[model samples]
Target: MLKNSLDCIEETGKGDISIWLTRGNEEDNFNYLNIMDTAKGIYPKQAEKIFESFYSDRKGGTGVGLAYCKMLMKTAGGDIYCKGKFNQFAHFILKFPKID
Candidate 1:
């Protein structure tokens, strides 16, 4: 999802794109999922709404993917969020608890 989202932004040439990826697990902490996106013309706020149902900054998607992801994560005791600066990079993070 993260890659696809980035691809959407990159293909449009709306930003300088780069990705710093990470994944790890701590003994009593959470599993990590991170995707950082450099989108020169994309604001994190705009990206934040990407998850809304039927809302796509661009075209050609039902716009329910991120919403569905949120639902599935909540069902599995996890969550998703984004952090980014306007005309800078956007970071999307999803974390899940380590199951015993």
Candidate 2:
């Protein structure tokens, strides 16, 4: 995902990729990591579809990256999601639930 973000910003001369990690609220019992990039953002529909297997819009892209991440998170009893708007930003939130 970081590599993809870096590639997305290359055409514009400059852009930003930010990552933040935080302990989620006690009620949630999760830790959170956010990866946000200022680049050519994705449409709402596209964002949802990106996690599907074999979904790729990039040349030479195997398209398994995001889908694999989702699978790993689920296996760990966590979750992942993406949200963004066109020409604005792309944000991916990963939720890691705390073990008992």
Candidate 3:
């Protein structure tokens, strides 16, 4: 996920990236890591599709990075999501449950 954010920043050539960590409610029992980047973001249609395997819009991009990350997160009882707009910004949220 960090790599993806770095790539987005590199692609934009001029933007900022911010990270936020927060704790979820007691019912949720999860910790959230939000990575937001001020870059050329993706379209709404691409938001969910970006997590699909082998889906990349960039040259020489295999698109496996995000898919793999999602798989790993799920395996660890977590999940990942993305939200953003074209030429605006991209925000990725990763949620992991707290360990007892």
Q: Which stretch of 10 consecutive residues in model 1 shows the poorest summed lDDT?
A: 16-25
Write model 1 residue lDDT over 1-100, tens digit each, in one string: 6656567577757654444534454553667577666654447568678677787665577778878887888888888777777666677778777766
Task: Write the residue-wise lDDT of candidate 3 on 36-57 in tens digits.
Answer: 8887777878998999999999
**For model 2, the run of ten residues with the poorest summed lDDT:** 6-15
**lDDT of all predictions, in order shown?**
0.68, 0.90, 0.88
User: Model 3, which residues run further than 4 Å from truth?
Assistant: none
Winner on TM-score (1 vs 2): 2
Model 2 gets an lDDT of 0.90
Candidate 1 residues lying further than 4 Å off, grouped into runs, are 12-28
Candidate 1 C-alpha error for residue 57, in Å: 1.4
Best by lDDT: 2
As for model 1, its CA RMSD to the true structure in angstroms is 3.4
